[model samples]
Target: MKPLADRIALVTGASRGIGRAIAVRLAQDGALVGIHYRAERDKAEQTLDDIRAAGGDGFLIAADLADPAGATQLSEALIAELRARRDPPQFDILVNNAGIDDRKTIEQVTEADFDRMLQINFKSPFFLIQKLLPVIADGGRIINISSMASRLSFPTMPVYAPTKAALSTLSRVLAAHLGPRGITVNAVLPGATSTDLNPLSDPARAAAVRDSVALGRIAGPEDIAPVVAFLASKEGGWITGETIEASGGQRL
Candidate 1:
């Protein structure tokens, strides 16, 4: 049987990039996926189509993580969708993969920028997990898509890095809190992935990033998705409260 067969997964920001890759990978492992998008309805549909094309099952859900009410609404909507299909209103995997990238230097930061970063990157996940706790199945998995920036300093990403650091800390805390229930929570840090969020189209820029990685190349979403898939599988049950760096051994 497939590892994730008869399972359910919800991947936030699944409309494109890393989230899309993770959602597709989970579906390939036989989990029914909830592809959540903030505003890109078309992209979400495309992701759903890809899942279907791969003979996997899934649906699209829209929610803006930046909004305080977003996570609750998303939970409600997800429950409704599951019920419509005669499935349980609970899920086995929750991938908190939605976040915004900030590239402003310390001198360029503002109160509004800081608030927006925290609201979407950290606050949303906290409340989303809180509100969705009842619906998350026991022995489930929670994967937070963090960044290598949290551990490595960047000149223009002072505020953004902290948010990822906060996420990693949350993963450890939740893993401990949920350990009694057999759930595993972990943070995944990908370094300089080639995605729309951080395109490496420029040869010089791409080469610069490649030179920093031990793998001699910047990673793509495909390189990161399988790691998350492993975490969602039964094989990953024994691992928790850890930060798994899928950064091609960058800076190590």
Candidate 2:
């Protein structure tokens, strides 16, 4: 399973949820995972520590993708940091998984919410990928964390879904542009996963949501991690510009 052994992977939003799971899974798969977090230093370190406990190599990086300056600094710092490592990591994998959720009614949706969603989820990935594209090895992989909401639209999810859609679009274009260089780009659309955002400890809402899924359970980040690892590996080298849904049969 060391398909990615010696590979260096940078996963944004590695502090928790699906992103954290992806980071740990990639580490287990033998990649030197770079754990990225915005402000959750404690959580990020925990991810790195878990990798160490498992005998895998890892390092922690702090990056605020929500701000343009921070995104630029984060990208540059990663390149600089990886360059300083022993083998000077070429960063074969880039998982653009960092994002934010804005829950608001149609009328309640303000300009600020829209701006923040696009900034972190859409714009940040756009620029970060551009900056990191050169460093990604030929035939490398890029997986963008999108949402099932991109296709399953709802009233309060207008802005969020649009952001995911834009990200998917970006993934497709990058796949085409980078394909000549042998890079693969794709998106993963997840359903209602058991994340901090879901307040799973709250039985009422949790029950209601679980009942909605055909699996009768909400997915955990663990449920989504292996697929990401597979896509990042040579096994998924053939898949590019694809949107693989990791939902637990929740609705459509």
User: Of the candidates shown, which would achieve the greatest TM-score relative to the real structure?
Assistant: 1
**TM-scores of the models, in the order given:** 0.97, 0.95
Give lDDT tens digits, candidate 1, residues 40-145.
8999999999999999989989888888888888888888887776446678899999999779999999999999999899999888898888888899999999
Question: Per-residue error at 53 for model 2, in Å?
Answer: 1.0
Every candidate's lDDT: 0.92, 0.88
Native-vs-model 1 lDDT?
0.92
Across 161-208, the per-residue lDDT of candidate 2 in tens digits comes to 999999998899989999999899999999888887665788898888
Q: Report the number of the highest-lDDT candidate.
A: 1
